[model samples]
Target: MKVRTDAKRDEILEIARGVFLELGYERASMAEISTRVGGSKATLYGYFPSKDALFLAIVNRLAEQYVLPATERLEQSLDEDPRVALQRFGEQFLTFISDAEAVAAYRVVVSEAAHSDIGESFYESGPKRTVESVARYLEGAMDRKHLRRADPAIAAQHLLALLAHGEPWHQYFLRKAPSPTRAQIKRIVERALDVFLNGYKS
Candidate 1:
């Protein structure tokens, strides 16, 4: 039996990501990925049980790479002004989701959601975890009297919603607009923080 190494697993993930992006979730098959990886279907299956599982793994990886760092910064900056901390996190969060890979994965998940549980799985693996992390930070802020007392989870959702509002990424997701520039993201985050702090400041 061959030893499963992290390098090999990463290679498989990279290849699978490309396949999914090029062919989409419904059209991309394990067989095709296996062929592309220069490996047998059994070997590929050993790493990822199904297409849904593979796709979820990709989402999880992306979240770890992008979302986790932003949330970590939010946690670390707890001593800073709420507006400053949130502005930094909001900018990073918007930038990550607006990425081409993230946008493509979102398209796949939305398209496959009605047909299977991939959407739920994707949410569980990625968005849900990020939300929980943000909620924890918000809860800490509330405890410190930096923000008003409220349901942290709901507050986190509201803050994130505000951050995403009217961004070009929403239209880009629908192929109607281009990816937002850094200037646009900075403007959006500042506006969002202004409104959020106005409502929630303690």
Candidate 2:
């Protein structure tokens, strides 16, 4: 058994991310990733076990780096207006998911979902985790009477659905629309929050 370090693991993840972006999920292979990492296939497998595992790790890293902190910021607003915290989260979520590269990655995941488990891996690592984080915040809001008591999971899904709507989201997924401007994103989020809070407020 070869010893592994955080440095080597990070190196593998960076290289794998590049390969996945360039060749996409279906075409990006572990052997190719190993070559780019300047390591033997055995070593790369020792670190990640399989291509799916490597891909999931990359997804997890990206989600944690870009998405988790935004949702976390909501916790600090417990004493403030719930609308403020929800708006911040909605904006951040929309912006992150609408990035060009992020859209491309999602397309790749969706394209390969029927043939591979990458879709499940992606949902578990990224979207599911994010929803759970949001649900926790919503649960807290309900407990404090900042929002009405209800099923936090269902409420979380409804809030995300509202934020994820609009022509920008649909067209971007089709690879035909540009990223939403900051002002556009703010408007969308504000409107979504308005609808959500109105329906959920005690």
Candidate 3:
């Protein structure tokens, strides 16, 4: 017989996220998680066999919750004017970093990647997917003569690097500065596009 969960999976995931964020994939203890969730480790184990299983669930959840939608938005905007397309993309990318919880999750991933294999998979599924999707868009625009000719992957990386030096990375890693005003984001994305397309446009 199929068994329904006696305890809510969402509730466990919610508490588990705090535990993983605070303690990270390596240092977090099941006993501590069980305590936080008001369950014995044995009960927690019934739901999640090991710390790694719980951590992996969080990683997979993050990719599903954040990354896929961001990429889908970009893919759907391929027909927009190149500048408008880029601007929309920039805004979506920026939103991920500016939100406090998303920023926190990213920082946690950065820290954990130094220690675990799961981190590598998470990077592939999320940030790496984002970079690839951006590159494919650049490639498509280049093919359509809407943008410049260049290696899409390299072009995409360059754009991301440019974006990073500005508000998102700064605000993500540095301090609780004010979110970048829309004017600031538009200006940078515009200037970056100008520089890039100037060199690549054929």
Candidate 4:
């Protein structure tokens, strides 16, 4: 048996991302991914047991590469003005979720949700993680008297919900509009931060 290397796994994931993007989850095939990766189907299966697993891995990878790190920065910057830090986080989170690749992955998850566990898996791996991260940050802020005492998890949910308010999120999910522009996102973040701080300020 051949030993699996991180390099080989990453290479396979890279090819798989492009293939998945080009053909989409329902249509993309392991054989095609293996061909692009210069590997056998067995090798592909060795790395990822099934197509769903591969797709989930790709989604999680993208989240880790983009979302997690950005949130980590938010946590690290907690000493900054709470409003400023939260505005930055809100903008970052909205921007990350509105990316084309992220939206595509979200569509794939929604499409497969009824038939498979992929949707639940995505929630656990992606959005849940982001929520938990923000919750932690909020908890810390509460402890420091940056915000009034409240349920951090609920506070985190409120923050995200406010950030996602209005037509940009709704219209995009409905396929009626494109991702929000930087200026639009900035306005949204500013408005959300105003409401959030007013409600939570210690």
Candidate 5:
């Protein structure tokens, strides 16, 4: 099957993402995706050279869908007061975890992480970047006297660990019970900031 150059790579990737979510990393076969996308395994290979390549493409697609939009939301609303910005940040970050793709990716990564470096790489690219972004924001806020002085990176990791509730988000990815509510996320962020500021006030 000849795929036109004009064929929407993103459209294919989105379909592929749903496939990954449903079947996970090892179980998700290329033939399954080929059928869904109206292409043969050969055509799929033309677009993605191997299973790892397909997974990587899907990971990049999910990052665009799940990460970039959330980042934009935070940046666009970042001009508000520090407290409100923090609240918005919590809301936006929570939004990512609530996503099916994000959840599925975490499950896939955690289940396979002990066996595959790919999973580790994915986490580094996605989760690690998020933590660092939050740290950078906190650090900048401190520089401007908007937030109290401290290790912003520590504060950043703290915010996430609280959101995770003592479990690395892998617990949620594993279908753990008692998924949090919006109010819970908001409350935790408020309390985290309170504790963080109390420790940092000079």
Candidate 6:
């Protein structure tokens, strides 16, 4: 039996990410992933019990590397002005999700959601946690009177939606348009913040 190690787990994840991107979730097979990783299917099962579990792990790993840090930093910015704090968070959020790898993962999740629970699993593992984190920050802002009283959870959803709307990123996600420039990201974030603050500012 192959002894499981973090290195092996990471190798599996990295290889599986490529397979999923290349073939999408439905078409990508555990056998293909095992073959790519140079391991038996039993060895792959030892690391990840199922394909859904493996996919969620990849998504969670990406979230931990990027999204979680940005949300955690939101706490550090609590003393700053609401606009400043939100602008920083929005820009970081947009930049990460607009990344090619991240977009590819989203595409996989969306495509597979109708047929399986992978979409719900992905949301529960990554997006739901992000929404909850942002909601906590917004709750604090409301208490500090920087923002008007409202449902922080709903506000967080609205802010995320606004940030995601219209952009080279949105265009890219829909039609394989070119990757967004930094200037385009900054402009998009600024516009999102403008609309968010106008509605929520105290």
Q: Pick the candidate with the highest TM-score.
A: 1
Model 2, span 128-179: residue lDDT tens: 8878888888899899998899999999888888888643667778857889
Model 1 TM-score is 0.95
Off by over 4 Å in 2: none
Query: Which parts of model 5 have CA positions greater than 4 angstroms off?
Result: 1-7, 72-79, 166-171, 174-179
lDDT tens per residue, model 3, 13-123: 889999877876567789998999886777788888877667767766766676567667776776888777777777666655566666666666677677776578667
lDDT of 6 by residue, 1-202 (tens): 5578999999999999999888987889999999999989999999999998999899889989999999999966777898888888888888888888888888878888998899889988888999999999999989989999999999999999898864554596877865677888888988888888999989
> Per-residue CA lDDT of candidate 4, range 63-126, in tens?
8888898789888877888888887777877888888888888889999999999999999998
Ranking by TM-score: 1, 4, 6, 2, 5, 3
Arranged by lDDT, best first: 6, 1, 4, 2, 3, 5
For 10-83, candidate 1 gives per-residue lDDT tens digits of 99999999999899877899999999999999999999999989988988998888889999989888899888
Candidate 3 colliding pairs: 148-200, 148-201
| Candidate 4, residue 105: how far the Cα is off, in Å | 0.4
Candidate 5 local lDDT, 50-143, one digit each (tens): 7766776677666766666665565554456767776766666665675666666666667777876767677777778877777777777777
Could you tell me how far off, in angstroms, the CA of residue 193 lies in candidate 1 after the best superposition? 1.1
Those runs of model 6 whose alpha carbons end farther than 4 Å from true positions after fitting are 166-170
> How many residue pairs clash per model?
0, 0, 2, 0, 0, 0
lDDT of each: 0.88, 0.85, 0.73, 0.87, 0.69, 0.88
Could you give me the TM-score of model 5 versus the true structure?
0.78
Better of 1 and 6 by TM-score: 1
